[model samples]
Target chain A: MTQVHYDKIALIGIGLIGSSLARMIRKAGLAGSITIASRSGHTLAAAKALDLGDHYTTDNAEAVRDADLVIVSVPVGASGQVAEDIAAALKPGSTVTDVGSTKASVIRQMQPHMPSHVQFIPGHPIAGTEQSGPEAGFAELFAGRWCILTPLPDADPDAVARLTRFWEACGSRVDQMDPEHHDMVLAIVSHLPHIIAYNIVGTADDLEMVTESEVIKYSASGFRDFTRLAASDPTMWRDVCLHNKDAILEMLARFSEDLASLQRMIRWGDGDKLFELFTRTRHVRRSIIEAGQDVAVPNFGRNVQAPTDSAKPD
Target chain B: MTQVHYDKIALIGIGLIGSSLARMIRKAGLAGSITIASRSGHTLAAAKALDLGDHYTTDNAEAVRDADLVIVSVPVGASGQVAEDIAAALKPGSTVTDVGSTKASVIRQMQPHMPSHVQFIPGHPIAGTEQSGPEAGFAELFAGRWCILTPLPDADPDAVARLTRFWEACGSRVDQMDPEHHDMVLAIVSHLPHIIAYNIVGTADDLEMVTESEVIKYSASGFRDFTRLAASDPTMWRDVCLHNKDAILEMLARFSEDLASLQRMIRWGDGDKLFELFTRTRHVRRSIIEAGQDVAVPNFGRNVQAPTDSAKPD
Candidate 1:
């Protein structure tokens, strides 16, 4: 047993990231009980059937009643609503956090609704797959990922430390940052990437020049990467785009302007400019791999002895 | 052991695809003698040191003198030069092909230089990772990929069939299309994706609103996918862009128009339109996965392993 860090932890979203957290917490023995809640009855039933939590309910408030830690893992647009709903029900001194992609917007939406009785630390686990829902989760998902926490000035240090320990037990390396910096960083990294993915995929779909079948067939070329990004959760991404509008637009402007310059290079047949940009970008992939973000396939399945799930090379 | 399909095979330009083919042919025992040839002395020496072939030389003409099959796997722009160099030395009636991305361009560049007695068939295997060089390959890289042949109307069928069988033996499914159609199809699927990836990564790098560090650290969200494509072989991709200009610009116009429409949707908070477009896109990913083009990963291995090379996580 990994050992329980909390007697009761309530998960408020029960979607992909939320469900993954629930599974990991269960597998890691980080919680004595997990109370699952979502706005959808169908999702609640599915989580109940999956045995994703020790307790399941469609009532967000009811889920957090006696919970020691409440994690709100919903779309950014719904964070405020969830915070309001569970504000009165949260136990005194309970640690409250979230796993939303955008931190500044999340804190702005959630912190005001939260009662001072609870510690509201905004967080994001920079990890996930295109798949969503409670059934689409596994315990090993967070084994080596980073989880950033953005806690308010008034937040209790002891509560933050405890939550840090809790995430550590769940296989996350925790880092604390100010909410504004977190928002700006993610605006460039996570939020901008999704917007561009959606944009490019939409671009291809609307094209009359290329058939959809052709796009999918030869996708191994490069277009397929955008499809994975494009396949992300519609509701969740819609909310993120709406919530992080300024930062996203700023990043988008930068992206578009940069693209214009590169396009000029192609138009002018500037191979040297193209070569320089291409060569510089290669170092980033190297850094990502060195930082343990990538595991080349030749080394895959080496230590993995028949994983219990369907994520192999079959 | 796989049956030896040819007595001798000469490979010109042992980069990513060329080196990969050499390895695959060796592993499958399809070539009695594998001759590796490239203009770069460093690479030829490296290929020889890696034992990638039975014969290694820097001269393309010298390498093809006695080979039954000649595979020119250089950047598309270099195809004409290689063809011109090897035209006299090729054994007449021997089959010759290329692994360039642009088909019409390759045919135009290589056809006049070839001996009519030699069956010159143009082929492109729609398979590769972002990495290049002889060491950056594996025998299974072509497994389950599509190998496209764009043969001239007067090209011999026997040669086409032989090349198709060779690709199949190397674990690929073969398809034939007109050179013009191949160029058009690939413009959307492969060329545009790489261009956009290069463009967007350039965008992120030059963004005044977000630091380069921010772009690098938060890449897991969606931007990293673009990075892999941006990090692709510049010379190969630059040639692809330059050679396939008309098709790429057509696709680009469609993409830009579609992106404008989607941008308007986001600007007006048209959730219904946004939701509809986003929802329709998800099926594309499913279709690709069903077609065995993409695989899902728990995370992008910083926290998870990338199940595939080009595509990034949510």
Candidate 2:
């Protein structure tokens, strides 16, 4: 199982996730050859400049021809078009999967176009930074992260096992879950936080009394943390909003309702209610740290930049 | 200017900020003697064990006796009580200030009780981590942080200058603002973020559809960023909400209104609006980095904890 290798691996998008996968495949020598393709010529040029794959092309079909594995890393909205583009070119018995955040939507978008001989397995690797594009990825992006697969009931077990070994070799732990459950889980953990972050940042920007300079100058207190997630890839997040509408909307509604109650508690001076909620939230952070999902560092241990003149003694 | 010194310094709360002040005074030899006091005996004992001050006391009045500088670092809700407790013992011509997050409330609670002979200037040092208590502080905690002072119009210029020198010795740049304006600025930059974090964490915890374990497992995607702020001391946050009520409520209302609009955009599938908002927020994060307020580390450069078995392959 450790010796599993793909004769050729075709990556359908050369953004952060796709480029990271290409780097990991090369680092582990898991693919005999790697082909990279992207819709943007500039991104394809960057991937080539980075020497990320054995073959690079703008044509999705050309990239997947004769490939044993095809991984679509585009926004979920683009998954259908890419699936249609590459379906005819996928070699017999090749396994097709994705690294989109929403698994159920990806399956729905891609499964119809897939050939009978090809296996389509939808997956999401629960890892990323706020950055995007080919230059933002690294070989270690998946190290110690989770790669969750939501395989169709009829997906060939042999193909699934082969892909599992591939992710494991890239230093990710693999798990299986139903696509619907994965969507719900991600909505709470991933989608809602980004939406909230974006909303709050937009609100801050629109405040007439509070100058943007003041917000930027004093952001270290707490606001800066939200800015990181709010600054995530807009195109990707927009696709996520469209593709996983039900779960995302459900989580958003719940989040807004909770916020209204909290606002009321504040308006009424209910210190006890506020304290109770704040105390309980600390446990979630502790559990995540214990679960090895995050490190227990103050401000994630970012090396703070030296104080500017304004923050220094005159 | 570097030769400025206090004959005696009293720290009237041995939590993270107060203990950090004690350490800085000791490290810089800025005070001939230091007294540390806390209502909680355990915290006072922790300060004593750490040798953070030359003296330790449970009596707030006793700690303030003959002190040339008295810095109250208690929760905002307790500022008035502490002022009342320490008023009689405050030495003539001594300076009394606070390190509370809310300036107007601190000034309101503390100013009336201060004798005319002693200068009562409200201050807030905008530096801290999620951790609390004496053991969580370090001498370097304020090395590159901002300390805002909201002095009364009648406050003596000499007294304000002396306290400014003290904060400089602690390695903080000091800025002066009106107490009300300070409260408003902090409401947008600090209090609202913490409130949002606590609210979301609470919502995720109370979810029936998603389990806490799943939230913890996938938190690295985005939820964990909020958790750090949510993990901050509950009592402190509770007091912040209660003391800075008007400003916090105003910010919360604005945040909620903006969120509702964002929710509508998502519901109506306005992908362009979503992308535009997300793209705009990125500029805030970039400005913060360029302003030397935060580093540009991706995901704050958290060292991935070595994967536990579940995140590792068999």
Every prediction: chain A TM-score: 0.92, 0.96
TM-score of 1: 0.91
Worst 10 residues of 1 chain B by lDDT: B305-314
- Which one wins on TM-score? 2
lDDT of 2 by residue, A105-172 (tens): 88888899998989998989888999999999877778878889999999888889988888888788
Best model per DockQ: 2
DockQ of each: 0.41, 0.57
Consecutive 10-residue window with the lowest summed lDDT within model 2 chain B: B304-313
Instruction: Give the per-residue lDDT digits (tens) of candidate 2, residues B77-144.
Output: 99999999999999999999999999888888888899999999899888888989999887777876
The residue-by-residue lDDT of candidate 1 on B224-283, one tens digit each, is: 667777778878887887788788777776766676676676667777887888788888
Model 2 TM-score is: 0.96
Q: Positional deviation of B28 in candidate 1, in angstroms?
A: 2.6
